[model samples]
Target: MDQQGQNGLMRTFREPWRSRGALAYVVAALLTGFYVVLYWTEWLTPAAVALGLRSKWLLYGALYSVAMVGGAAYYLRHHGNSRYNRVRIAVNVGVQVALAFLLPLIMPLFGGPEAYLSYFWPLSYDKLWPSTLSSLPVYLALYFIVGSLLVAPLLAYRYGKRWYCSWVCGCGGLANTFGDPWRHLTASSTRSWRFEKVSVHTVMFVAVLTTFLLVLDAATDGATGTFHWLVAGGQWWSVKQLYGLVVGAILAGVVGVGFYPLFGPRLWCRNFCPMAAMLGLFQKLGRFRIAVKKDMCISCGNCTTYCEMGIDVRSYAQSNQSFTRAACVGCGMCAHVCPRGVLRLENAPREQADKARVRLPVVDL
Candidate 1:
C-alpha cells in the first residue's frame, strides 16, 4: 500500500464507529433487563432457594450483570488495537455469567452449599479448620479451601495475579472496563506506594485476626473466663454481623467502587483488598514479569500514564528492569499503550532474575 493509503487505514482503525455510541447504550439497557428477568422469574429455582438468604444472590447477580454488560459496552465504545481488553471482556463475562450466575443457580439442584462463594469473603478459614470445633458442614469447608488455597495459589504461581485480578475478578473487571477512563488518576509516587502497602496489609491483618478470633470464640463456646470474654468480644465485633457482610459489602463494594472516578480504577484493590494482598504474596514468587525492551523506548511516558496499578513503568523501562513489584496485577495496560512496543509480558526464571543482560549505551539504555 502507498504511504497515503497506509495513513488512511491507520485513521480508520483508530476511529471505531463513534456514531454508534447510542447502540452500546441500547444494548446495555436490554442486557440489564434480561438480568432482571432471570432474577425475578427464579428460572434457576434451585439456586434461588439456597440455604442462606437467596436475596444475597440478587446483589451478586446485579454486579455480574453490570460488569458483563456495561463493561463490554464501554469497551466497544473505545475499541482499538488491544486484544488484551477483548480477552479480559470475555473472561469477565464467562466468570460473571457462568460461574457467578448460572452455576450458582444450578449448583443447588446438585446439593451445593446454600451460601454462594464471594470473590473476597467466601473462604472463612476460621470455619474451615478443626472440623469438630465448629458446626460448619464439610462441603462448605471444602469449597473455601479449594477456592482460596488450592486454586488461587496454583494460578498465582503461574500467571501472577492476572489470572484473577485482571481477568476473572468481578471487582477488577469493573475496574478495568468501567473504571478505565479514570485509570490515569492512580497516584504513581513513592509516597503513595508506601501508603498503599501499609493500607492493604493492614486490611489483610484485620481479616486474619478476625478469622483467628472467630475460631477461638467457637472453640471456647462453653468456657467462662477473662480469655473467653476477650474472645467473645472479638468475635462479636469481627464476625457476628460486621466484617464480612458490612465491610465487604458496603465499604469494599459500594464505597470502594464509588470512588473510582475520584481516586482511580483500583481504589479497593490497591488500598484495602485483603485478597489482593494475599494473592500478591504468592505473586512475589511468580515467574511472570512485564519485561522491558529498553532500546525501543522513546520516553514519551504513555505507559506510566495508563498504569492502573500506579506502577512507575517508564522508570522500569528506562532501567531495563522488569516489573518485580508484588503489587503488580499483570494487567498489561503499560504494554498495550506503548507506541514503540517497548514492553512485553513474559516469564523470567526466579533463579536467573539477577543475571546480567546485553547493555545498550547510556543514550538508549
Candidate 2:
C-alpha cells in the first residue's frame, strides 16, 4: 500500500453487516421501521419525555450525535494515521453535534428561533419558502436568504461542495461517519451513474418548482384560490405536504439512512438530495478535481471500491485523467485508498489544471 492508502484491512465484503447480506437487510428494515415510527406516531414522545428532551426530534438529534461520535471513533481507529482524514472527520463530527443538533435544541429555550445553521435551501427545502421566512426573525430570514442564494454557491465555487457536504452538513456528516462501514457498497456501474444524473437533477427541479409555487401562493394570498390550494393550502394532498412527506420524510429520513447497509452511505446524496444537486452545479464550475498521476495506476480498484458516491475512479486513474465529477462530495477516499499514489484532490486555476492534464499520457484502457 502507498503511504496515503488506508492503513488496514477494510474486510468490506467479508463482513455480513457491511456487505449486502441477510444482516444488512435486517438492519435496513429496523432503521426504516424506526424512522416510520418517529415520523408518523407519538410512540417515541414518551421516551423523549422520560429523557427530559422537549420533543422526539430532540431525542433523535441526541441519538444522531451519539451515532456520529461512535462511528467517528471507529473510522479514526482504521484511518486516523492520515492528517487529512483525522481533521476532516473531527470537524464534521463537531459540526453535527454543535450546529445541527445542539444549537437548534437550545435556541427555543431562550426565545430564539430554532435554526439549523448547517442546513440551507433546498435541502432544508422550506428555509426559502415565503411562509417560513415570514415567520422567522429578520436576522435569521436574511441569514437563510443570503446563505442559500449567495454564500453556499460562492463556497461551492471556491472549494467545491466539500465545504458544506463533507465538512458541515449533517446528512453528509452522518454518511461519512455512521455510513462509513458500507461505503464500499455504492454502485459504480454506468447504469447507476445514468440514473443518478437524471434522478438527482429531477429532484432539484421539483424543489425549485415547489419553492416557486409556494412563494407565488403566498404573494397571491388566496386570490388564485386553486393554485394556492394546490401549492400550500392546509391539505394533505397539497404540493408542500407531498414534498414534505415524500422527499423530506421518506427519501431523506427513511430510505436515505435506512438503506445505507444495502446501497452504501450516499444513497440520498447521490440520487435524491436537491441541495447536493444544486451545489453540484457550482462544483462543476469550481476548481476542485481529482488529479490523477500519469501511468502509475496499478488497477488495484481500491479507489472505486471505496467511493461513497459510486464514481468509477479507476477508469479515470487508468486513463490518467485528471477529472471532476459533479457527484463527488470530495470526501478524499479515492486519494486515500489509492495504493500507488495516483490521485490527489486539489483546487487550482483552470489554466494550471489544463497544463497538467495535457502533460499526462493517457493509457489505453
Best by lDDT: 2
Q: List model 2 lDDT by residue over 192-305, tens digit each.
A: 887899999999999999999888888888688788888887887899999999999999999999999999999999999999999999988888888889999999889988
Candidate 1, 213-279: lDDT as tens digits: 6566657772656654554444645353456554465446555665565567788888888788888
Best by TM-score: 2
Q: What TM-score does each of the candidates earn?
A: 0.74, 0.95
lDDT of 1 at 269: 85
Computed on alpha carbons, the lDDT of every model, listed in order, comes to: 0.65, 0.88
Clashing pairs in 1: 51-114
- By summed lDDT, the worst window of 10 consecutive residues in model 2 runs over 356-365
Q: In model 2, what is the error at residue 256, expressed in angstroms?
A: 0.5
For candidate 1, give the lDDT.
0.65
Off by over 4 Å in 1: 1-60, 109-111, 115-137, 225-242, 351-365
